[model samples]
Target: MESALAARLAAAPEEGIAPVHFVWIVAKDRASGTPSPMGIWSGDEDLTVTVALPDGTTASRAYLGGLGLEVEGLQYVADLTDNPVTVTLSQIAPAAQALVRGLDVRLAPVEVHATTMTGGALTSAPQLQWVGIVDEGPISTPAAGGAGGIALSIRSEIMTQLGQVNPAKSSDVHQKRRAAGDRFSEYAAVIGERKMQWYKR
Candidate 1:
């Protein structure tokens, strides 16, 4: 949170402020050459709000309400669980399933923001709450008339980076990428195969 928002929140009670969740997601992948931004908010009515972009710039984005969005796993626990937030955009019928499928949201950056503890009366802009990358999107369609929607698995930036498999390995070629004369891992392969006589002796 920004310093101003933090100060205002400190004075406001948790229950007194109406926290509005604003989600900004990219609808298409950059490779498709027509990437677009999609914004939605958790509010009764639609309104434009100031949201921060991935590049640290502020933009006025129109957020649609009543679309039905539920955010899960936004908790601070003492346990060591690397849980990803599952955001379900509900009420997406089969007719709109094709539209959702066309969205290349994987690996796209997501920004979640919230208004101050108090509702819109305050002049401060919405504060950024969570930033993550879209891990995957699995869409569900009802066979008859059951409720269904698109579920987006969003992993935090830290968790996403930790989950990535590093290309560099313990080898001569990998070590050379760091430094030309670096040979620390040159014998890594042979050292594991070498046996010690400590057990026999």
Candidate 2:
């Protein structure tokens, strides 16, 4: 009975096979002022990586263990781990850091004077405008923005609060992807051997 079940299980098709590798390419986007990873590659022990630098140059190499590659003139580092490879660029790049710093400074709300129009006319009506104030009303608390906006704000705050959170998340995703990829690779190897045996029989 156990043998029969085992045979049935072996014969069953794989349902959902997730990618075994998650690659995080941490680099500055020239257009968008955000840090992001370029690509994630997944595989087992043996893997080939082709790195193309910002300069018109490329290098292809095979890596073992955790691979870290850096070019002298380039401002990025390519890190290849067991599961996914992560490439991180220096946030404080010479040309871009000043712009980034300026943006950071500008993130604070700038006070601007504006004329308020009432009833489609510039009427001098003495009305208390709730500007830059939170109204904690009775019955219920003053609601903030929409669910999506709030959620996004929360996520952004969390990410910003914990700077290394992104790296940690990337690492976790990489591990999961690697495990899945390895399992699939192993299964493929097994199936190939089984087919060979069946053909021989």
The lDDT of each candidate is 0.71, 0.27
Worst 10 residues of 1 by lDDT: 91-100
Which runs of model 2 end up more than 4 angstroms from their true locations?
1-41, 65-201
Error of 2 at 121 (Å): 68
Query: 37, model 2: CA deviation in Å?
Result: 18
Best by TM-score: 1
RMSD list, candidates in order: 4.8, 29.7
lDDT of 2 by residue, 99-194 (tens): 222333222211111112223332221111111111111111234642211000001222234444444333434555757543334444346455
- Residues 14-114, candidate 1, lDDT per residue (tens digit)? 53554557787766744664766777766656778777766789889887766566677776667655678877786463312432565667677788777
Model 2 Cα displacement at 183 (Å)? Answer: 69
> Which pairs of residues collide in model 1?
17-117
The C-alpha local distance difference test score for the whole of candidate 1 amounts to: 0.71
